[model samples]
Target chain A: MIRIEDLDFSYGRDGFRLTVPKLEVAAGEKVAWIGPSGSGKTTLLNLTAGIVSPDHGRIVVSGEELSALGDARRRDFRVRRIGMVFQEFELLDYLDVLDNILLPYRINDSLTLGPEVIERARALAEGVEIGDKLHRDVQKLSRGEQQRVALCRAVLTGPDVILADEPTGNLDPSNKERVLDILFRYADEHEATLVMVTHDRDLLPRFERVLDFDELCTPAPAPAQEARA
Target chain B: MSDSLYLAWRYMRHHKLKTAILIGSVTLILYLPLALQVLVDRATEQLSARARSTPLIVGARGSAVELALSTLYFESRSPAPIRMAEVERIRATGLAAPIPMHVRFRVRNQRIVGTTLDYFDFRGLRVGRGRPLAKLGECVLGAAAAAALQAGPGDRVNSSSEALFDLAGVYPLRMRVVGVLERTHGPDDEAVFVDIKTAWIIEGLGHGHQDLASVGAEGRVLERKDGRIVANASVVQYTEITAENEDSFHFHGDRSGFPLTAILALPPDDKSKTLLLGRYLGRDETSQVLEPVAVMEELVGTVARVRSWVIAAVVLVTLATALTMVLVFWLSLRLRRRELETMARIGCSRRTVASLVVCEIAVVFAFSVVLAGALTGVTSLYGPSLIRGLIL
Candidate 1:
């Protein structure tokens, strides 16, 4: 369900670079990218989500080449085919929990917010144990509740790939387990691919595959070239 | 666009106090200039209408604006007093009919205008209820004055004292309200009309006391020499005129010498108007004769100039307010940058995000326009009274 090859990305002039020769995750696979800080794990998630185009890369998700698509099409693909959960649980504060969950439909014209979609959203909120607080502002929710709201928003589109960038970074141990269990349950039930980046090592055993970035990506040779000059 | 507007509405609703302040600021910015323009236009129209109707005024040599305002609108400080003889002098000219005006006293905030019945005929003032002034101590109130005092025909209105500390000042006369004038929507709508003699009584020039020659006057009489009887301060004086004592109310001196505020002279033709105006044009003329239109026009011209200055200041203030509003929006945008970035990253287009901001501003502007329109409508409806209050 996901493929990347010859990925070479950089934050230019900062001398930071990422290199991935070949990486693939099967359909329905749950994968985790674990590494030290600044290991470019979150960057890869953003690239896969098409939020930013890599300097050079060929990325395929669900039979569509993300790098080949235009900016608008890439955005559309991201909204329709890939669900993203952020470490910060980036929900708009002005909106209540339901609006935050339905944000994907509100922002993208490809999805229509019909009565059925509203029913589905309510069901999704009920599944995540936030049905009663659907009208409460996301800002007033607990950190765990906010993450669940973000999870509901992510899966509301029924995307093929769920990319979670440390979804439980700010939660307590119990809440972290609950959020992870819900994410895994959704991937298992829907046959969706899951790619999560995290710093915690204890959560690694639950994933189908764990890619350690310490060996996978090597920094570019710009400083060596500078020394030679 | 609808979606963007819905999102904007939610954002604004979440920040309710901020939205209200913005709407109020914009409303005042839009309303101040509009209300001023309406008020100035209405004042010009009303003042010109009243001045054009009155032909001429004769008052003590002083500010013509004051004399015109006091005599025509019963507003401004009462002009220097001219004797009732001036009214007779204009009558003697055989060119115009003189209507004496004594606008010197007040019943609370309402001005009491003392004039003859000719004033009612000349101004086309018809009584809306009961009868016009037919006797001394009987008054006809203007519609607004009566409404303000909540007094109708058969109600009594007492004159307000000129000074609080005057130990021997004139007593307040409890005059019977015989009628109420139909509303003309001019200065006349806020005045009380009475006979000149009643005004003199208010001025302490005329009074009634117990008859010293009667049987009960033995203690009150100070001297009884010749045909004149002198009375002491202890003598009982009537504070009001009734049917039995109306005959006893008398002026102390010659009636011609009593003070009048102005004389309204209505000439029959242009030749008479010119002749009457020429009579008062002499260098040594004690009283000034003026065409009310000319005096009012000069005053209107000054107001127009001041209106221009006010409009210019308003324009500058409007520009400054607009700039400040823009700055506020710009700062708010900066503060909400994170929220906007989240929207874009969530697949909202850059254009849609921008539309959301624009929609918020548009809603605020729409509310402001409606509020300003409502305020301007109210100003237009009550413009005449507002002008009266402003000038008076």
Candidate 2:
């Protein structure tokens, strides 16, 4: 389970602010964050990923308190236990798709890579229909293909929680549904928590629960905090 | 290759043009000082060895440096000729082995050095082909001289004229190449060795002539007058000396005034050297004696001072070039910031990312060092021959 308590975050005093009193996500829950632009949905996702710590809050993912760890330890924890997919599909241009998918294991010494891990990476490429382009430069791939590579990298390590910020924001309707199916199936098979931020309301029906960021000014009946999933 | 190096090499391959330009520039910059130092050291070795072996020189009063250069390397032109009397006078001192040198002419643009067999022994020269100088007009060629003329034993070489318009100029003489000497890697290796008498023959002081006055009205030979032996309009001087006319070759002047360009004096000990130097110390206008080691020391010392400035300039240029390289590398890293950020997001520690970047730079530096070393190796191998060809 992932938990958040009394989180208060802001860009600056003059910028946008986010506040949450309490929230908890079950170990295998599928939660979606939906809101309009400037809703701090991506900021909230970044907080969960340990990319940005809150001004006043404590977060616990997989029962590990993130606020207690130092910066380096937090980064270590992020690389070892959590996987994040960026909105921009931040693929390293110098590396090919296969290397990009294997990047996490390359950097994190705590992760032991074996023949089975290599085979799983190859299988992930095949499943995403980028098997032929595994050695191709990532920048040369189409937007949809690059997006698939990013999704493959996110789940390649089979992390405890997958925090995806606008995972299918730039995909067409057909690619959007296909990529969503892949992400959901990967999460369900691993029994991992999935927290996805999306502007598309059409994908909301598939989630077990959805949080609306526009309701920040009101005290609602739903959960007040968005946790790991 | 280590994992970091593998990644560094792959990145370098990805940017092949950049890598090559950097390495090429570095190699060229590095090669400058290395090549200069090697060639200078080699030339210095050659110069000092010859100078140290030839201890003292005696010539008509003039530049001591030029006289030392003349006798030590045989490069002096129009060196005021000292007489054989002066050479004998010095040899009588019982303090030296005075070898007379008369090298005022060239055969096929290579110096024709006229001296005794002691020159060979003094310079540690040995016969490599055929035999040593055994008779007048019989020549032994140095290694480079033989290579230049492409003439060996049984072949012939002709001396070149020093003056073209002088009506009384000495006729060029044909010399039989009797031997070739082993390479000494010194100035002697580029010289043609001949007996001192052969040089006087080229100077017209001695010549082979016909008995023109002896041809009587009845076409019979007759005893010649003392004045008739002198070369005149009627006497036909043979341009060459051979066994058939070898008896006719004679000198018309006294032995006291025989032409000798310079005398190489090798002292047996320091006391002899001091005695010779003391004899020539007060005689300024008549002649001067010089130590080649001292002369060459002064010359190379001056050159080495200038070389220090050159080395300083090379160092400054290298520093500037290296600074520019660092700036270019820093700018390239700035351009790759997003790439580094991507690596960071992918669980690369900041230190690991820095290592990746530094590893790429180190690879370029290491490869360039190797390239510079390779270039130096090739230049060191071939540079001596080029320098010898130019100056020997």
Candidate 3:
């Protein structure tokens, strides 16, 4: 579960501030954030993942307040409790697909996922149809394949929460549906919370809940016909 | 840890040019200091060895350093010649065994030494060829000198100018190459040996034609039979002195007028050396006896200070280079900010990234140390022959 109340963030002095009010998601919930450009959807996802801290409000993930923890402790908390799927895929080119999926466990030694973790990862890869590409370099994969690899890596550790920012932005329509199906199915089966941000309306009905960030953020100007008199 | 090492190795292998440049700079920095240290150490060893072997060097009262360098090291300008009388005075004391050395000539650019047969015994020289210099005009060559001139026993070689360029005063005196000395690993390896009378003959002091009619009526008929007058001829060539003219090489004037450059003395014991030194110190003027080893020790003491300072500077520079290399590597890591950030979001830690950078540097430095050490070892083994070739 996660909670954000009146969170305001800024890049620098005199820069625009992103404001979010009263956002909450429960355990095993699958939610998609739909917004136009400049709606601060990615910024909210970053704050939830503890990659950025809120300037004016609090954020809680898996019942732990990320804003109260120091930088080092926050990094440990993120590694142990949350998995992130970046928009750019963000895979290390030097590592193969298997190592990239196994990286979270390697970093946080306290997380004792046994041989069953590898089995779960292999099953997840097969479910995503990337089981044949396990030993291949991540760079050699196509955009759709890379997105599926990112999705599998996100839920590989069975973290309490998964934050995906524009996960299928670069994929075609059919691959986009397939990626979303695998992501939502895995989150529901493992009882893990999923928060995805996207502007794609065709796949919006697949999620259990949808939060329209246009209403959560500052309202845009009226349309041209309404303003023209 | 293994994973980190694997990542480090993969990164270096992918960036081959950058890795090579880093390793190359380290190799050059380490090579310079190590090579200089080895050369200076070897030079100091050679200097000390020369000093400990030669007991006392007797020469004209001028530059003691130049005298020791010339007589012991075969370097520097020739000193003013001393007299046979001075040699006899030291020899008659019975406190020391004196060996006279007349080193005012050279054979084909190699120094020609004129000393007694006892010289070879004292120096522990072994003949690799025929025999020692037993008779007048019979010469022995060092192994290097023989190889350089392409001469062996039964061949003959002539002396060049005694001074730097005294072509008008050139006296062509041929010497029979009687023996070749085995390699001694000292200054003797670059010299040729002959009896003392040969040195006098090469210097135009004995048995040399000098205007026969101007000398005496007896000398005139001998010059006419040779079809030339010594003063009129541009060059004077003297034949080898045999048993017929062995006594003719002696000085016509007082024995003190004969030219002798330096006398190497082997004192009987510590007490006699003290007495001999006291006797020389008691003199009024014109000559001084000195212990070569003592003066050399003083010289080496002065050299050691400068050497230590230079070595310290080299060490500091090497350390600075290493620190700079580390800094460059750190800066390079920082330059890959976006790449590293991507790795971090995926799962690598700040610690793993740091380990990767350290591993790359360790590989570069380890390879450089090995290469520099091998280069130093090869240079040390071949450096002596290379120096001999350049000098000789």
**Top candidate (TM-score):** 1
Residue pairs in candidate 2 whose N, alpha carbon or C atoms collide under 3 angstroms? A195-A229
Error of 3 at B231 (Å): 13
Candidate 1 per-residue C-alpha lDDT over A167-186 given as tens digits, one digit per residue, 9 for 90 to 100: 88889999999999999999
> Could you arrange the candidates by lDDT from highest to lowest?
1, 2, 3
The digit string of per-residue lDDT tens for model 3 on B300-364 reads 67666767897799889889988988787878788667767765664456776777677777788
**Between prediction 2 and prediction 3, which has the larger lDDT?**
2
Query: Which candidate number would show the highest DockQ if scored against the true structure?
Result: 1
DockQ of 2: 0.34
Encode model 2's per-residue lDDT on A54-125: one tens digit a residue: 888888999898867776777778887787887678887767898888877766555666788878999999
How far in Å is the alpha carbon of A167 misplaced in model 1? 0.6
lDDT for each residue of candidate 3 in A1-229, tens digit (9 for 90 to 100): 9998988887655555677778899989999998776667777787888777889898999999998887666777777778788777877676678767776765544455468888887888888888999999898999888888887777776789988888888888888888888887878787999988987887789888999976776633333332110
Residue pairs clashing in model 3 are none
Error of 2 at A32 (Å): 4.5
Q: Which order, best to worst by TM-score?
A: 1, 2, 3
Model 2 lDDT at residue A61: 93
DockQ rank order:
1, 2, 3
Instruction: Give me the runs in candidate 1 sitting further than 4 Å from their true place.
Output: A220-229, B92-94, B124-131
